[model samples]
Target: MLKDLLQTNASFEEELLEEINSLGKIVDFKSNDILIDLNEQIKGMPLLINGAIKILREDYNEGELLLYFLEKGDVCAMTMACCLGKKQSKIRAIAETDGQLIMIPISKMDEWLAKYPSWRKFVFESYNNRLDEMLFAIDNLAFNDMNQRVKNYLLDVATINKGRKIIKTHQEIANELNTSRVVISRILKALENDNILKLHRNEITIL
Candidate 1:
């Protein structure tokens, strides 16, 4: 679901969905499929219909940072990284499970928007919301303490999944918090010892 603001006057969601139905066929993707790649042309915007997708980026010497976790009914076409005129994807969409998506070319989207003002409003709102979130993440990482940042991230994931058996590793967590793996490991170990959490291979169960 879209977790941010919406323009009151526009029924962008409905119009966008209608546009998707008019485009190319729905495609099935397996886990780890690179739905879009960095520096790749913008072929289409995808509406995730089922399963989950992880949006991320990896640094040369550092690991990946989990930008977002998009699920069913979520749209990924409005981000600047994948906007129609962009030459490359700023982030990667990695399928977390067997999933289905509806892909619509950006060109079609532009055409569709021209005919439907609501669709244009919706895309603009969605893009603004994404930008806000990215800025929020950056601000927090730059200012928040490590412990509080980790706690906040865990809380965020817990809210998303309903409970806290989050299937993630220290390295991943570290990346998300923009910290070191060793630091994350140390913090996680402390939490486990305190019975605040339990850790397995790559999963952490909140106690």
Candidate 2:
């Protein structure tokens, strides 16, 4: 899997691949598994080999808001940050599906940074991309109304699932969006009334 995924990337040269294969270990998680909790110590950086992981931020009130997703071939920038800075994670990472990943030790980060130019480039690029995604999330919350947000959220879910039917309850959507279940139900009902979606028990079908 690593060979197929990393071989095409310009950054992963033969030497780098050898190092990664030798130093990294395979890890797996089931769907909905909490890969990392808020304030947990970062042990290593994870390179996703398959499946998806949802990265979330939690507030003081214990509300979780989606930050971004790490899909196949993507790395968790926040994890990299925590590993390099020796800080605890401020966000939560959960497996969106059963997944496999390669874990690279934090101790070798600096050594790899000095030894491989490609590693530095990959890290910086990942950081910048993640920052952009967070900014987009903030913009959606600050600028969009609840209706628009709900609509966008549904669209995102459909895209992620690659299907028109979303198998989730109103309460589940509310929890992820950090909104009240009542609000989500109202918005979903309104969308249903508008012929935009059909909501049934624990499920929603986009129309």
Candidate 3:
């Protein structure tokens, strides 16, 4: 099963896949589980298998906000840098949905890069993709209004979860968008009245 998941990346050769199978372990996670935290010693990188993981950027003054997300066949881009540089984690990772991910030790990452051309290419491409996403997020934060941001956030959530039903609390939405729960509630209600969504206690059904 682990090898199968690794093969999904296609950039991994059979030899590298076997190495990963031997070196990594798959772990199950529940929704809201913290896989990595700010300032923590970097240990291993997680390869998402079957669910969504939200990566958050921490700010002492402004609080945490969603940086991006890791979906199936994705790895946290920052983790690669932290692993290679021997730096502590600057971002926090939380499981947005229950799923399994393969944990590859940081020790093996350098070796893999040196030994496997496919691995090197994969890592570099991941960096490029992540940078693009970060830029898009920054653009959204800079020019988009709160209402538009909230709507975009919901659309992203719906897409990531692969469903129209978004099962998240107002506070959770607020944190993802870096706003107060009261603000999120107000925006959500307005959206609901506008026939954009149907709001339940802790869920929003997109229409």
Candidate 4:
């Protein structure tokens, strides 16, 4: 499974692939599971095999702001920073869906960087990709209104889950968006009246 996933998604060379196969450990996570928490010591970097992970930043009052969603075939650049700097995690990572991870120990980052050109390139590209995503998040929060942000957030959820139906409660969505549950509920009700979506018990179906 690891080798096949690497071949299909990652750009690692055969030699580095062999090393990863030997050194990387496979871990599984279920939906809503906290993969990493604030101030936790960094140990290894995760290479996503399948499903989605939501990366979040902690606010001043112990709240978390959603940074971005990481899909299959992605790595967290912030996680990379933590690993390389030998520091604690500054963000929280939650499994948005059930998934598998191939965890590479921090000790091997420099080794792979020096030994494999493909690994070096992959690391740099991953960093750039994540940086772009975070920047977009910053912009969205800075300029986008709450209503548009809510709608766009639903669209994103649908796209990520590959379906029109999103299995999230208003409070959950509000928490992710760093807003009050009351605000999310009100917006959702208005959107339902607008016929943009149908709200079920705990799911929102985009129309």
CA lDDT of every candidate: 0.69, 0.86, 0.88, 0.89
Count clashing residue pairs in model 4: 0
lDDT of 2 by residue, 1-207 (tens): 567854323457678888889999889899889999999999988888887788999988999898888877788888888999999998899987788888989999988888888887878788888889889889999999989988888887787777899888898889889999999999999999999999889999999
TM-score computed on alpha carbons, candidate 1: 0.78
TM-score, candidate number 4: 0.97
Give all TM-scores, in the order shown.
0.78, 0.93, 0.96, 0.97
Model 1 misses residue 21 by how many Å?
2.0
lDDT minimum window of 10 residues, candidate 4 = 1-10
- What candidate 1 gets wrong by more than 4 Å, as runs, is 1-19, 60-62, 77-81
List pairs with backbone clashes in candidate 2: none
Provide C-alpha RMSD values for all models, in order.
Answer: 4.6, 1.7, 1.2, 1.1
Q: Please write out the lDDT profile of model 3 over residues 13-74, one tens digit for every residue.
A: 77988888888888999998999988999889888888999999977785888989888888
Tell me the tens digit of each residue's lDDT in model 1 across 67-157.
7666765666434335566556767777766788767676776576687776677667667766776677777668888877787788777
Clashes, model 1: 0
* lDDT, candidate 4, 132-203, per-residue tens: 989989888999999998987898888889999999998999999999999999999999999999999999
Q: If ranked by lDDT, best first, what sequence of candidates would result?
A: 4, 3, 2, 1
